[model samples]
Target: MKKLSSLGLLFLLILFLSGVSQIAFAAENPQYGGTLHLSNDADWDTLDPAYASGFDAGEMAVKFYDGLVRFDFSSNKIVADLAESWEVKNNNQNFIFHLRKGVKFHNGVEFTAQDVKYTFERLYDPEVASPGTWVYPMIKGTAAKLAGESAELAGVKVIDDYTIEFDLSEPFGLFLTHLTLPYGLIVNQSAVEKYGADFSQHPVGTGPFKFVEWEHDNKLVMKANQDYWAGRPYVDQVIYRVIPQPLTDIAEFEANNLDRTVVPEEERERWLNDPEWSDYITTIADLSTYYLALNSDFEPLDNPQVREAINYAIDSKTITDSLFPYYVAANDAIPEGMPGGSDLPIKADPEKAKQLLTEAGYPDGFELDIWVSDSSTSVRVGGVLQALLGRVGIQVNLIKNDWSVFYNTVKNGNAPAYYLSWWADYADPYNFLNALYTTDRIPFNNQEINSLLKEMTITTDTDQRIRLSQQIIKLADQVGDPYIYLYHTSTSYVKHPWVKGDLYHQMYTADKLLTWWIDQDLKAESTN
Candidate 1:
């Protein structure tokens, strides 16, 4: 009997050890030769970053293109991406860049200075009609030609095969930051010469990922570029699916088929309470301002009292609470978290709104129409706003449009006192305030705004420039330029529990993909 018992005990102990080992292995971040999935609010149906105006397209661009300079998310300063280093001289009039020595385009051709010159010249070219054309006009003929008013770009010059130079027409603080944008992404002269119009369907760049193929409104695949100058990207593949509806995104993500998604406000509570959701719901206060852009140059918006009444009548807190409980209120036109962001003023006085309305000749209130996108976030807020304004005697007719179609229509300076939001493309306040308001030229700018923009652009002192920016925000408040004040919004995402690296918010227009990687079990173990 004693011998039998000893044999049984030995067997039990061996089984226990085997089970413990399995448990330890199961808790690790599993890495496989697989795809990392991401979903967006809508399908940004373009592969060419130059013509892809929306940020949705911008997000995928880091996988397909390279820029002259990249922003260091940690420092919010300029760093090298394609060009190894650069110097600003000629008394701040010229910027000369030295390209990386051995960078190769996907086509197997060496990337050179000619590509940089071509990028700027194309933006101003009549055929490209690039959305970023307005921001680069100082490069000489680029602006006038892009606006269809001229035929040549002036300031861009190729110093040599590895050197590129630009002469700024004036002291524009955000020019370098703008160059780091998707518009500034360099494509191989060889690739363009090879692909022609089909380049939109297929592109090659000195980026971390290379284009595989686009299956239309289904899937877009990008495989790791093994020969990447930075080093091979950690994820093997990145797959993007065109799940247009927000609910579809949530459903697909919950099914473990996707890695990340943009959660709209309507479903916020439901998703927050779900058992399947662990840490996946991501919410961050987007460095954006949600406000109504009044065509102050025309219509009811031209009336200062009309604009002020609309502003005062808005209960930014209530709408934000009912829809996005995770958001903050807008104190000014400029969003928070950038230089000079705090200088903007804040207040919500109904009496002040009423007084402005009365002074503008409408003691009995007025009728107005407001346009907004039909996404859950935009629609929910628009609904709440419509009701709020109704209470204050401003009967606003709300119009909801498709996102792309909506932007195209409203951007023509005919935007009908619509609800829209703006995010800064770079680190500086100049990018935030000046770009939209200073353009009193093409679409036309207000004289006051144009003059203020000129002063802000020329000022060299950092502190003085910030003060001038504050003055611009103050001026915007006094006038009803961007007429509505909604709440400041927040966004949060669940990051698969293993992804690591800098999640940059001010990535010009997109997040960096090169540094991000999955935590393979070999390196670290997961608690779950």
Candidate 2:
């Protein structure tokens, strides 16, 4: 009887070991199904890629749409998306793209070269009024299209059902980078015509996720596309909840209600010290620049001395210290680590600021209206600026508006002075210089700077392009002083350990939602 009992015990032990092995294997391998809960501080302005001007809209746009090419996170180089391959011809003035076969839009319509032609023509349509039109003006015949003289983009041609071509008016060295912008994303012509003006609400595209629903200020949900040209997303669904308050999002993350969230400035240290949470935290020095934009067309700001005084009044070092570890004080228009970025002689000198203000005919400091988004962080920064500018005799009247209103106001160059940040659309320094200092966006212009910018666009040599970028920055600083350079921002987020395959990219305009998945068993074990 004792021998029999020993044999039975051995059999039970073997079964136990087998169960343990199965569980271990499941934990290590990629799982196929789960949900990822994410948060956005505000509702996206629009899902229409053509008019998606803000970060919120961009976050959602890339998931539902795709462009001809996109930035590969691993290489930080342009890679094909819808297009299988492309060729630069005619001295870089003419280009051709070979589209992937059998790709279908969300509505089940097969994609073709015609769709590509329609997308670009719609973008150049005056009725669209896309802010991104500037990115493609180098295309031949855009002038006639913009003026309503032509309904078609004369430069864009459909070579066949599987191929398309673009003829540029000039050789734009950064043209591929231009195609990587969200605005360059392709759309189905039938979908746009069906939805008409309400297309923003009903977006259709050939991407990894399909739009399920958007509950206004509450949450936006997307489901994986089973027919995605690339394999379907690991997560079954992606939920982006609009939690405007940072603290609230953090609380949700801690309570296991969220998969990941941005760690608030006040909570960063605490999260880093926690044994369990610290492992989940990821940080990246973002390719973004935060600054105070003084409208050069507006009142005293039109005076360079006044702009210089405003720059001198703000103690950037102090501000950088207050947000220590999250931001680095910006010394030039370009973000640190980017090519051509350098620290100029600019620094905070209260005395110098006072002298400049006096020289600009505002000895006692004058009242100025500064516009900012209603986000808590923006408001806090605005208050800090108001205090600093007050020290140099500028009374700042803080005007806070929701992101949509604030984005439009500043984008239209209506705000006298505004606290804003420019996130990198592409890694090139010209992206920053051309977008911020050009007369098209900001009210400041110097013929020398403008000429250098135009030259930088076509300069193919990396070194020569960098040299031109630096020259433009120096000239803009000495002459235009269009913006008060503040600091470059960082991205920090604490994610649950079970949330896997996420990356904190330097240019994280779009999160790689398709690659991410949740380990349900591990999450349950950890939460419990």
Candidate 3:
């Protein structure tokens, strides 16, 4: 044989790895039957779709509920779920959905257009006070209903048993994408009536899996729905073990007691380098951003120079490098990989930050209290900020609280400064810009940016929408320095070799759990 050149050797290595990956993937032939053991640091707050907010609850919602449309991970597009097809007319203000035939809820209730109407009406109901109500402002008469002026939303209409229509007050381009979120998950009307306020405990929906049990801080169990329209789930059951500590979860995963769990930051590199464990790790850049939110209404933070100085004091890259190996430093409020996102020229400049503080009448710096959750990541980030801001002569006091208490304090605007992360509810720039900046939760505001955001929602032209989004981001970066952009997160999870399916989703983390299965032979070998 002729001597192979260096390039030929590299090509051969690539070919070998590619073939190995394919063989490894194909080895587990989509078998059915087995319980998937998973873990979460926090327990779910609620399983009711109307009130599901956190990642834990959202994960459960994905298995126990079905929305009109769902995001297709393969195509990265909005595809049909319960609603098989849809049509838009009247300049995007009107929408008609043709429901999938013979779909049944977990309780065997036939899914229909009436269920769709009921779900939205409940969302818009003032008494319900669902957090999901934010998603329905575009629908006609929703504002009036929310304000107690009307009892019904004039937009949702049951055209027939298998069809429904929506009339928006104006054109909203993200309407379809919004329907893919938990808020749009349809519920059986009878179940809601039967369960009432306790529906969160006894949730019923049309999905691949049905709720089996939830033992508060222990575990949540779900079983496959044999009558599911999509098809019966591959896994027979899913048990989410509530392990509060990441280290504990990792320990369980290593012991084979847990099928999958998040790999702790301390062990990430070691696991990646170990050939025995490398193939089990899966990492994906999450569509999310973390930031230090300054209550712009507060004294020092109200000053533009002070806000800018705070942004300049902390080095986001250094923080990410030390504390979060999987995260990328974010300079712009909008995360990277999204359209219209651009990085700001913000970096650590302690001297400039001090000068800006002096200019804002705080020559000796000022004392600021930062409220953060008790999560490992939050505590580390808070400690880093405390140290960095101290270098600029700012005295920082970190107040740590449980997740629920911390979230309530920040959401109520009681915290002068807080650390939080916003994950995209839908894959749209508007969700990031409008939800974080324009909302009353944060004190940032600019009439031009707000107007542009509103116009962007109505604008159908892609180029015009992109331009408007870019303008909004630029204006927010210049004026509304309410948040110090930190970093975008990359999430990693370790799965046993027997676990098989699409496990990563940019938006919905656990949505693909229904499709995952365990190889009987591989699992048996691991146990032996």
Candidate 4:
């Protein structure tokens, strides 16, 4: 969205010939009184920032919550959000933040350093079982606190009502970057206490928008916060209507009932080539990687040679080539353009694959079941994989499950193989590498990678950190073999010409909606 750097040159030439000014038409001036209509295919999991791990939940969380620090796409850096300013102390091992004054949660409770302390402690709470504890591994007493030996997060110090300090056990280079995630978003203790278990349904935070209503499987609405620390959002209201299908979302957008909708993979080419729709196509190359996960805990796959054989069997370049403009072949663990991202010397070799399978005692190939989520993209990708692996004498049975079943199966390490993607929470190579490799998600255990990942966190030098991460990635490819790197994702959306200041950012969970405003005159003109 920033510059269309990844868009096809031929598409740009088409736009030029058709007299279209930009990929996504944005009005020069903004009008502030319209409701921004949008559609989501699934319902939000939760509104509470701490428990919101799914993308849909995060999309809602960013509207209703404010993290200490947030990604600033305009500058492509981490900028202060709730904290007015911050300073590093004790040789980058401690962070002292000066909080903004007079910020109020949706429930009208004033925000303070106590809220920050409460939020981190809540994340580390053993009873909570939150998925966010990984974001604060460098903090002092993290192990003890998570192990339930300590009640307090000793590192989190409330200096005063308006100031807070975090003492890290080591000098973590991405400390500020980690704080940009929704996990670091501050919440009022009183609000959480009041809602108790229902806190997720009723979120209270000091963001640009306040939660108003949610009709399950229908629509969720948020109104602009009049007393927001920052100025109010340009749009008076933001509405997310749940339209279960991509085709329905596109239909709603065409009917002028929705502001924008994602272009389905099947429909992207037609929309891109059609002169009538080409101008509205907004494509963003995100910091994400889609891959085929081979669970090492499972038999046969546990053999490194078998894993390598599987990798060599599938032609990733060919798959990505067919999905052109939407994706690029992923050569390494880290995505291209990010630090430590590189092109690895890996390719499909049917002969080598067959040789390795025989060496691993699977000469006639073996039956393996690959669980796939019930999304259209995942199913389509699974079919391609089934065909590719069959070529090398490996029979892959595709098991398509709904999101809940697929997620739990993978999380519980029950899936021998699965199709998944990793999108960045922060624009760091560490986020991608640490998430896919270290977690039980894929059950990959590489001592070399594990040690390097630990060192990567505390390494303050940028180049040194990059080198360590790159080494870890290469090791994962050569030895770990947990996943067959597929492709990096690019998302395209059809946006209305009246939508102003909307940018498809790398950090999609950040509050991009606050900057978007509807051009009333243009909307009226288009409607006429």
Show where candidate 4 strays beyond 4 Å: 1-27, 127-129, 142-151, 322-325, 358-363, 374-376, 400-405, 441-443
Worst 10 residues of 4 by lDDT: 1-10
Instruction: List runs of model 1 lying over 4 Å from the truth.
Output: 1-34, 143-154, 267-282, 297-301, 342-346, 373-379, 399-409, 412-416, 435-448, 459-462, 480-482, 502-504, 508-510, 522-528
Q: What is the lDDT of candidate 1?
A: 0.68
Ranking, TM-score, top scorer first: 4, 3, 2, 1
Task: Report the lDDT tens digits of candidate 3 across residue range 183-298.
Answer: 88898889999998899999899888888899999999889998888889888998888999888888888899999878776787887788998888776656788999999778
Clashing pairs in 4: none
Question: Which segments of candidate 3 are over 4 A away from where they belong?
Answer: 1-28, 147-151, 358-364, 373-376, 399-409, 460-466, 509-512
lDDT of 2 by residue, 192-232 (tens): 99999989998899989999999999999999999999889
Greater-lDDT candidate between 1 and 2: 2
List the global CA lDDT of all models: 0.68, 0.82, 0.81, 0.82
Model 4: per-residue Cα lDDT over 378-439, one tens digit each = 88899899999999999989999999999999999899999998888777888888888878
User: Lowest lDDT 10-mer window, candidate 2?
Assistant: 1-10
Give the candidates in order of lDDT, highest first.
Answer: 4, 2, 3, 1
Instruction: Give lDDT tens digits, candidate 1, residues 1-528.
Output: 011122223333433454453455346533444467776556666668678676767767767788998776444566788988888876556788999988888878888898888777776777876776766766766656676776545677888999988888875655677777788888776787688888878978888889998888788888988898988876889888888777777788766676666665667677667766645554443557787677766566777667767777776767756766666666665554445654444445667777777788776678777778887667877788788777667787888889997777687655656787767676566766775675431133567876877776666567876777777777776765455656555555665555554253534354656655666662345423
